[model samples]
Target: MIDGAAKDVAQILGHIPALRRYARLLAGDAAAADDLVQDTLERACAKWSMWRPGTDLRAWLMTLMHNIFLNRVRDWRHDDGHAALEDAPEPAHEPMAHAPEMLDLHRALDRLTPALRSALLLVTVEEYTYAEAAEILQVPIGTIMSRLHRARETVRVLMEGPTDAQRTHPLHLVKR
Candidate 1:
């Protein structure tokens, strides 16, 4: 039993970096991301017995983090305007010397809705298959497809600006 428990802890530890990356992208702030990761670890440890031995541990961890993130967002929405200090807008800092396109892409990603962003990140960033992403997000495969389509289109529009056709006509009227 001791050996089994130690092995489980080792496996969970190995996924920490991935969890931190996912949390960082989802939360969009380092401090908040760290908090999310900590909460996820706590939850995972508490529920360790529930995890199936042969299942995908990384995906399971991601699903737990996703649920926690969504719950926090829901709670934040219900808050009475008493925002945390971390939620306060920070003073603008000089841009890093990174490539402009990368900066643009990051900004575009930030503009995405959490649902859309999660779908995009799970597939693109995490390299999960559509089915796997759907499972992680706890949605139907078709819903995952729809979210990916919308997320891609939105990011493209945000990064490249409106196309000439889009500028000339409403989005609905502009045929792809």
Candidate 2:
């Protein structure tokens, strides 16, 4: 039993970097991402005994982290003004010029509904399989596909600078 537990701990430690990257994508604030990962580790440690053997540890940890983030969002829902009004320290000394393409992508992402954004982050950024992402997001597989469809369309139109209405229709998707 001790050997099993030790192995599990090692497995969880290995997933930390991937978890941090996903949290950063979700929150867009490095400090907030670290906080979320810290909370996730604390939860994992406390609940380690509850984890069964022979299951996917990475997926389990990700699901826990996702729930933590959702709770934070729920708590912030009632707040009115933009919270956390501090400047992110610029990339030391020399920051890359703000590329127009990058700016538009960020703006388009900002417009996504939270559900769609989470799905895209999991699938595109984290490179999770559809099944794993659905499990983490706690959504049906079809829902993941549909959200990705809609989010992509919205981003495409926004990036291309407002194409014809026909192109904007979600049903008429032109997959990239």
Candidate 3:
């Protein structure tokens, strides 16, 4: 029979692809994202005993990755030498197989703050509920909701500019 530890490792391994995607989005640099994923896996193995069996392993792993990403962001903010990924120039435009709308969405997403982006990704891309995302993000439910609202509005504004309802048009005097 496979040992419990081995089973845990297998489960964690199964989530690597997702972790990588989330990391890429959070880091915005391929090399940095890979490093983040590696760090997350290492932390998971070292902290395996803390994981409760019968719980959502994926959520737990996501939480670990999110925390690592946040720590890295904090360090980057404090460090003077290294530049944050958001400031890095956009990657050379390569032909992509995705739809144009998807590409536009990605560009808009890049503009959002890390907190908003993570909350949006968890709810929309990862299909996690507000409660699950809050647990993963270590924030209260209200915070997640607030982030989601802001993220959605930011993305909308970025992608489509202001809608007619939100646009303010200057009044023009007409000839009497």
Candidate 4:
């Protein structure tokens, strides 16, 4: 049998394509995706010895990649003097097939607190369970549920802004 280190290396190799696929989806830029994948690999290799065998390696690697991205963003913000975000030309906006509600939904998501947005995306977009998102975000399950509820409410309010204000008469709150 190969040594444990060798086995770990093989496992990482097997996971590279999946990692790249996920990174690509996350970054939306090919070069940035590759960088994210590389960052994840470097961190994973460094921590290989500590990784317990037969556990969920993919989730661990994904968590590591997420941290790598968050750290890079934190560093960029911290170094505003020399590493400011450049004024790149915006990509031309093409018409999407989304409904009016979708536009409001996207805007509301962008406007959400990062904690709430992240929780919502992890659970809804990425299809992670509330428990899995909680584990990944290092928050309690209750926090995930609260964030999900808040995110949905925010989106609904945004989508209904005009309609809500245009009502001719207010509905009674009484149960009669």
Query: Best-fitting candidate, measured by TM-score?
Result: 1
Candidate order by lDDT, decreasing, is: 1, 3, 2, 4
Candidate 3 residue lDDT tens string, 86-129 = 99676756466258877788789888988999999999988899
Cand. 4 TM to true fold: 0.66
Worst 10 residues of 3 by lDDT: 164-173
- Candidate 3 lDDT at 145 equals 100
- TM-score list, all predictions: 0.90, 0.79, 0.84, 0.66
Off by more than 4 A, model 2: 1-5, 80-97, 166-176
| Candidate 1 lDDT over residue span 32-81, tens digit each | 99999999999999998888889999999999999999999898889988
Q: Clash number for model 1?
A: 0
Taking all chains together, the TM-score of candidate 2 against the true structure is 0.79
lDDT of 3: 0.88
lDDT of 4: 0.74
Q: Which pairs of residues collide in candidate 3?
A: none
Please give the CA lDDT of all the candidate structures.
0.91, 0.82, 0.88, 0.74
Clashing pairs in 4: none
lDDT of 3 at 115: 95
What local lDDT does model 4 show for residue 101? 64
Question: What alpha-carbon RMSD in Å does predicted model 1 have with respect to the real structure?
Answer: 3.1
Candidate with best lDDT? 1
